[model samples]
Target: MTKPSSTDRPNPLQVACSSCNLRELCLPVGFSGSELERLDGMVATRRSVKRGDALFRSGDAFEAVYAVRTGFFKTQVSSEDGRDQVTGFQMAGELLGLDGIVSDHHTCDAVALEDSQVCVIPYAELEALSREFGELQRQFHKIMSREIVRDQGVMLLLGSMRAEERLAAFLLNLTQRLQARGFSPTSLVLRMTREEIGTYLGLKLETVSRCFSRFQEDGVLEVKLKHIRILDLAALRKMVNSPC
Candidate 1:
């Protein structure tokens, strides 16, 4: 048998929904082979965005949703005070542009945190396909439902959790999401800056730093700038679950 070379490996960009590694985490779930081919047709094209570039700015018309094929992104909303708040972070296999659907225009800015590639699922085509496929319709609704649930959890974190609890919960959530995407659950390279994280967690930058230092002193984790190595996942969990 001829030996397979690097060229033989599947190219992520060329792979269709039926063969994509992220199929389990994307829209391909619950779709049959024939359905997957049809689903692929809805993805009009692939787009590349450079770091620090806006995928879609607030007030831009919403035409499609994007599936992250590579790299990370952050969504933000600007306040009347001229301050910007980090709303969420997105990684490979996750969907973006949903915030635009309700109003027919993007409500926040989706910016690339790294050089990224996304599969563009044109909204009209996707809606038409969903109408023809009952399973697809249900799956799309389920995805939107999870997004709503995630937002509720964020509200709970901000309203009730203490600084440590909020930070811990944030780490735990990030770790779990990374794990789901086949990355290490206990280690991560933070894509957003500390200030952005503080904004999201409702803490000051110094407060976020203090929490990280305190966690390290307690042997819970090791932090070196953007890189983090979680040493005591159970301890972090306990901190998040403990009463304020």
Candidate 2:
């Protein structure tokens, strides 16, 4: 990907973590002004990715971890049979590129599900800053732990959950994350397509569509193409928590 032009960069003061609205979600809590400035300095640039483009691909050198300043992304890895398997979806205020920390190269492709911008935090500089700030180090560790936990949850979804249950859990997770970012808990426009959701949830495209229809028939959701409104949140939660 080409570097963003100098003119496209946001003013440092504007993008500084100290004043960023996402600071509470993206940064460790209770950092002093000085610490926030230092952390902000680690993010020296912002990159814009257009819809349908990849921010990073498998085998690319990992130089930094990106913070999604806006929009959404999906990370996927190719299977042995050459099919792309969607691993996870990431949204604004979330971090990406952690997959490369152990190997120094990205193992999956991070593609924009919509037009997106990310704060580029150079990993080396971030490491230095984290060393000086104990809270930053702890927060970084917590982020990694969360990724692990999410992966385990995906495993459970694929291994045992029925198609309806898998889709219900996926919607619940997506809505919860969006709600954390101040979005309505019941309404959303899905950034990824039904096919992509099927790929992520390990369901066939037709099966995914059928499950949506079933949910609508059962008064659980109001579906209008990409727009989804949960008409019965309690029913979805019940489906997810139902005995296997």
Candidate 3:
């Protein structure tokens, strides 16, 4: 078997270094050299998360917004039955917990689905930085816009898409997402559990299992336990883009 190629991620930012992928979206892209330096100094710390680890639980006190340095995570809210209802998934270079800043507390739990790193930037400090850096405010707005767009996409996907269509589209979305973060999209290990997936998709566990088997039997995808190989992306796209 061929081993995956390793990528040399540049040395992490001491304070918003050019090496950071999120600098473009998380910080002012057009900051004057001096302004950028000052803004960087306010950033305090970063934390690493392993698969199945919770970055913050629902109702945790909000301190700073977390920017993904690597890997993927999911956000979930507890349902009345004591089970979690998955609400969001984030990838490398994305921001998590931005919404919590407004309320001063977390509304959902943020859990890592794979080994991940996060850079925490204090909201109170950012308010001060935004005054000195006009572009920093713009970057904040850009991130907000992306959040709105993603939420809308999920609503549309869940309400209108068929079960099989939803499953394939979800895989395709995950594949393209991982690819953007420098991972192989075609054959990769599943990070999130099947139960998490079903909760996110609004499907029963048995239904999700059956959909996987049907996709495999029909040669659209190959599934062996948790590892998946997408054999027919074109067909999957057709399903996702199909008119319901």
TM-score of each: 0.92, 0.94, 0.84
Clashing residue pairs, backbone N/CA/C < 3 A, model 1: none
For 146-223, candidate 3 gives per-residue lDDT tens digits of: 789988888887898878887887898888877866678787777777778889988877888999999899898899
Count of clashes, each model: 0, 0, 0
Quote the positional error of residue 186 for candidate 1 in Å: 1.5
lDDT of 2: 0.90
Task: Give the Cα lDDT of each candidate.
Answer: 0.87, 0.90, 0.78
For all the candidates, what are their Cα RMSDs to the real structure? Answer: 6.3, 2.3, 6.3
Residue 160 in model 1: lDDT: 91
Candidate 1, 75-107: lDDT as tens digits: 889988988878888888889999999999999
TM-score, predicted candidate 1 vs. hidden true structure: 0.92
Could you tell me how far off, in angstroms, the CA of residue 38 lies in candidate 1 after the best superposition?
A: 0.5
Candidate 2 — which residues are off by over 4 angstroms? 1-13
Ranking by TM-score: 2, 1, 3
Error of 1 at 168 (Å): 0.4
